[model samples]
Target: MAQLIKLEDYVSRYEWNAYRYPSQFIRMKQDNWKKLYHLWRNEAFVGDQQQANMEPAASKWKSLFKFGFRKTAEETAKNSDVTDLPATENELRHYFLDKLYPVQLKWASSTVTEVSFVDQTYYANDRLKYFLKRFPDTFLVMYHPVFNVKKAPVDGEIILISPIGIEILYLIEKQPGTLITADGERTWLVKEEAKSETKILSPLLALKRTEKILKSILKQADIALPISKVVLSPTNHIASLKAPYNTKLVGKHAYEDWFAEKRNLVSPLKNHQLKTAEHLLKNCRTTAIKRPEWESDDNSVFPNDTV
Candidate 1:
């Protein structure tokens, strides 16, 4: 799953320490997956091995563990808890998707803030799921992030930071089989199945704005990384007379290939990658309240130095 480093202007634990949390999240995810696999296979572990395997994720997220990741009892009741052990492989995947994935996202995005998202509604959002599940962990995404450019806050499209570079993605989702014609800088024509057409504000405008903001930040930081922009639509066919230079246009027909290329990329987390993310995050506009308990109970909220 791609790490959701930032969601809008929501506070993130990643924002606290980009270098630390990404590696920690990867470790936690791997460990949890291994536990799930063993449970699914019904493999017997001897003595302490079984105990260790059964340890709840609360131990991993020491800070948010107290509030139980801030989920209400009713919300928690919606899905089978991970400890119940899934009976089938399909159920196992769903368990991870339904239970663990949200926790990971919360751990990555919100630590000291109250993120108001209705449980079922937020979980069922297809766009959020696409960013989380379709890409690898090495890819860190900032969804609709707000960046502080020229001391003014500017909203941006999805910013994907990979080991290789950064990609600004503008998603243009429409009704299935809708035809999108990109012909103007101000608006694009969307033709639905009934042949009714409408002009919507071009996503390219936002993409270019985001690209410019990132470029300004990167240039000031004296950090160099390949920055690319992509106008993506997974369910609509995009027809463009002239493609924009230094940008990719991925419509429905080519979505799978583009997605596969990202998933297939194999690379270790690089220093520059984290550094770029850190620089960008530093310039983001964050609105969050400090966790009340942290005033006196900082120890519980933070991992031990040894960790």
Candidate 2:
């Protein structure tokens, strides 16, 4: 018989709250002995449960509801915290979980990137931090860079600067069903279950407008760089979608692959990367006062051109 593991022995109080439901995690530990017994006797049953546990959240729940109560059994065996057992499971779990859900970290107000010109700061949420951790060298990510446009301020959710080009990313929360976009339209239609439909402002249009504004801002500093716009639905269960030309509509699963490809394609000279980084850092400020253009006297302008 396999030795049974107790929840209290493996999980710390903080890890319990950070990742899994406290009650659910505890219940699983209490029942693991029976689960292990069955696993040994019936390998087929164990395999089936493991498969169900690996499915996506939506399908996982559907399978659970159809065959009630067995889902928890599977989860107890396959939960990430359970599988990656450490010698000091409690301490190791705490360390890893803290990275994902830091204690007392006020993410909304906390600055992720270094402060730039005029005390400009960039904040990060959990999803953005995930990307930052994975590709630290490839991207200089700025979160919510505010720009002044016609006496009003506009905020771009994320600005990614890389050797290949600059990317302005607008994040969208997960929405159910299919999204349909049309060329030249400002909004897209979402069709949900039972043919229910809703219309929302197109993320592509928002990105384009943001790009135009950003281009104008960069022009003032005499920096002209290629810009691309992307709409990222990090948590969305995107079934099907049509996106505009030259715009990227990226889903959560595709993000890593998409970014990896871009990273591979970009090979900037060290000095060139440094120069671009410095220029953007100097010019892109959240609160820098705009300087008026220098107006020279006509005599001064004509001094070189005239006799």
Candidate 3:
């Protein structure tokens, strides 16, 4: 069985696990802030594997463990081993990679390196954080919703399969521009200047690949729910291109309406699954450095590490 990782609520760990970028972690763990914080602080290990201290019946052990904490419930494991949180993000690779990770990594590495990039990235993250604060684990998936993989199309990243929730596909533009998609034509508007189109990765396409991988993973878990993918834009550049394919290219201004209007989609995770996934992603190591703290949670422990 997969080793079950426990973690406390983020709010509890607010002092320790500071969010360098609020967009990623804040988007999902907002509501659980108080409880999560307490959990993180009060975490204790109760098994040989040394997982975090989880609430009674909070985490469900998986089906693939060989021994140790996965085997016995000694109830005296160390705090490091028995957390109320999930596994660190470094553990995602062992699970699998979805399609979105590679593309986002490329974007973060190549395209995203400017004031404008930081601005929009923060904008999207802000929107996510807003929802998280209001809905907590009910609306959003665990942090990252999609985890990144090292290799693309080869060592497929495992989708943390469970039930369905909102899966957002971000299409952050690197420049200021507009898009034209009235007819079958697609073009770009640079600084209000129109130009023939260039081939770039569209959030719409990313959604397709993510959907394919998620479908396979969900099926394996016997989950039949489908996640809706929306194209999120942090700036007006989203208007420059024509989305000829089936895609929802939404601007920041309309983010709330889009997210709020989302009907029929809901998260089915119990308290335990949500906590497990949330803990797992929080520790995801990203080469992407912290941008700046748009708003302060005021409970972060790693203040110097983040803005």
Best candidate, lDDT = 1
Candidate 3 structure quality by residue, lDDT tens digits, 177-278: 554232323323233345555544334445566666555554555544545556666555355344535456677667666656543335444443343334
Across 61-119, the per-residue lDDT of candidate 1 in tens digits comes to 22222333345566556432423434467765655554455665566445654432324
Instruction: Please identify model 3 stretches exceeding 4 Å from their true place.
Output: 1-135, 140-164, 173-177, 180-198, 237-246, 261-307
TM-score of every prediction relative to native: 0.80, 0.48, 0.37
Can you write out model 2's per-residue Cα lDDT over 141-205, one digit (the tens) per residue? 55555544675655555677665567878877645544433333576666656777777787776
Pull out the clashing pairs in model 2.
174-236
Higher-scoring candidate on TM-score, 1 or 2: 1
TM-score ranking, high to low: 1, 2, 3
Which TM-score value belongs to model 3? 0.37
Task: Candidate 1: give its CA RMSD in angstroms.
Answer: 6.2
CA lDDT of each prediction against the hidden true structure:
0.74, 0.43, 0.35
Sort the predicted structures by lDDT, highest score first: 1, 2, 3
RMSD in Å for candidate 2, one decimal? Answer: 21.7
